[model samples]
Target: MSLYQTSPAVAEALAQGRPVVALESTIITHGMPWPQNLEMARTVEQTVRDAGAEPATIAVMDGTLYIGLTDDQLVALAQAQNVAKLSRADLAACMAMGGTGATTVAATMIAAAQAGIAVFATGGIGGVHKGAELSFDISADLPELAQTPVNVVAAGAKAILDIPKTLEVLETQGVPVIAVGQDALPAFWSRESGIKAPLRMDQPAQIAKAFAMRRALGLPGGQLIANPVPEADEIPADVMLPYITQATAEAEAKGITGKSVTPFLLQRIFELTDGRSLKTNIALVLNNARLAAQIAQELSALP
Candidate 1:
């Protein structure tokens, strides 16, 4: 792998042993519309800062991996058409070929671990898509988390996926799923998945200690801190189920699959909910960012 050049701000933070939270880039390019996406990207980064850490949002431009983007780059990327969505399988290819790409959760984790940033914040992790039993359409995120040593804070698996199966896969792969301040695993956009988390940690310091212990034990995989969305911001599982079913059915009817499926489903859900989903999504991501920053701070305190 080519040496990744960390941004000046991120480099200094790492050198000083200050907390740094890594962020994925697909949310900016594939998850939202232009101006709003750019605004949300900046807001998420600022939230991490407000919570006492620097945010390092990862992406690729002309094959160079960037730890953080300048304002102009963020805006241009948000509005740019035809950007590649990079994941574990394709990340190296993009960098090697000198192509611009947005980092997904899997790619972000790889970059974060390489940069020595132990914590990452994202809206949600991808998982076993519905009908994966037949389609075999699982996300690379599972294996990425199974090997990379980053502490990922997310609202849980995206609501569009099969939550139980996703949890099962994570368990089988030996990744820790620790719920923050809750017993039930959270479903993105909703506060409850009605499934209890395998592990629970109420304090960021406790979670940080867990990561430390994992390293001490020579564990290979990372940890997934499943932080639930704030109650006021949640859509509730019941209220969201029918909408998700309808959106999934529509996607199937249109034969949208693979990389196109997620964006299509999210857009359909946004239209179906009159943009409430997007609003809830933004809230959940910011909440996750705040929690990730706190965890990063805690981790930084470790020897």
Candidate 2:
């Protein structure tokens, strides 16, 4: 059996050296409600195509690692229950056990690198949870960025996380967190985190060149392109802070830990915000998809 499977469109694109952006499946399987999740997945994929690249949504189904999903597969996975959330530690094990799984940022990067894909887009990355000093619950996504050579475009680390500590961990891991069109790192649903980014790039071509230069210098890690959510779609940081704090407090009080923390906080925030948070999330993800497509195009054009 082959180590991976690819949809016909993605396979053709890869064979022809066309631009392709890898998408994570956890956004579909674990990030949203059933029909909304499917709709978001479709929208993000179409966003990539509209920006002139193929979108390869990665997932594992019945023990098979699929580099891209068909339409039916997307629908099935969206409505599937009890799907494993796979990251670096459990991705292969999920496949080995013939279990269906959704790919998190770390797992998606691993699959993207394995399939020779150079770019990925998502709403946000996991990061140091608030109070991680004692909880020691840093996310796997940070270390994966330090080692995987796939450009991950996102609004930024999820605002629910400890943004300052997240940046510190990224810096310590040697991951280049480059804010696009600004110096301030974006705070997922908000455009500015008040934390100055260590690096900034104004254009996709500049990002592409940096990516190539890193490879030339034998750098093993990928870059994080922090694309801010469009202004009209964003909830100001001040407006979001209280909702985040309330949700975080709820999660802690409920004793939610491990993989359960993020989804729980997100759901609580969604409720606390009267559903506005989910809308902002969808907007940011689509925005990242467009930027990731542009970066992929530039990467493909490189010699």
Candidate 3:
């Protein structure tokens, strides 16, 4: 039996050489509350479609890797409790145990590559946690981008992380971090992280050409397109900084570590911002989906 399965829409699109934008399922299962999560998932998928690309939302259900989900499956996943958040280290284990899992950036890239999808869109990528010098904690997403051949379009690393160190790690891994329409790296929820991006490409065709060029050169990894959140929806860096600092401090005081830290910080930030953070998250994800669809369309036009 094949380990992977694709929804009819995604399969048809792939077979027909059409543009398809891969989506991560963590946002549905772990990023938000029930009905809203389901709503967000549908909206994001539709956003990709509206941009002239098919959407493939990846996940693992009963040991089977689903390249895209059916409506019923999306509902079940949104309502499912305690779904394992799968990443590079435990994705296989979750599958072996027949557990349902939400794909993180790393796992999503792995799945997208396996399914031959060239682009993915997400709210943000995980990165070096604050105070990583002591915890030595870093997200596998960085290393995955260094090896996986999927172009990831995100608002940038989550604002709660150490954005500067994350960029350094990406640079060290020989990954291309391209900022779209701007020279500054976007800190998730904010339009600018204040650290200049190493590369900037204004057009989707430019990003597509870079991807093609990398493949032609036999580069192992994918590129990170740091698309900024729409300015109307962004929470300026200065306004977000204190909230992030407080949330990080709270997490540390509570001894929240590993995978728990991000969710905790996000929830706390949501509270601290009077629910504004979640709204910003949704806005940024939609922005990324739009850009990813454009990039996928360009890539599909390539030879």
Highest lDDT scorer: 2
Steric collisions counted per model: 0, 0, 0
Model 2 misplaced stretches (Cα beyond 4 Å)? none
lDDT scores of the candidates, listed in order: 0.93, 0.96, 0.95
Flag regions of model 1 displaced more than 4 Å: none
lDDT by residue (tens digit), candidate 3, 111-149: 999989999999999889878999999999999999999
lDDT by residue for model 2 (83-118), tens: 999999999999999999999999999999999999
List the candidate 3 regions with Cα displacement exceeding 4 Å. Answer: none
Candidate 1 vs 2: which has more TM-score: 2
Candidate 1 lDDT by residue in tens digits, 158-229:
999999999999999999999989899999999899999999999999999999999999999899999999
So what's the TM-score on candidate 3?
0.99
What are the RMSDs of all candidates, in order?
1.0, 0.6, 0.6
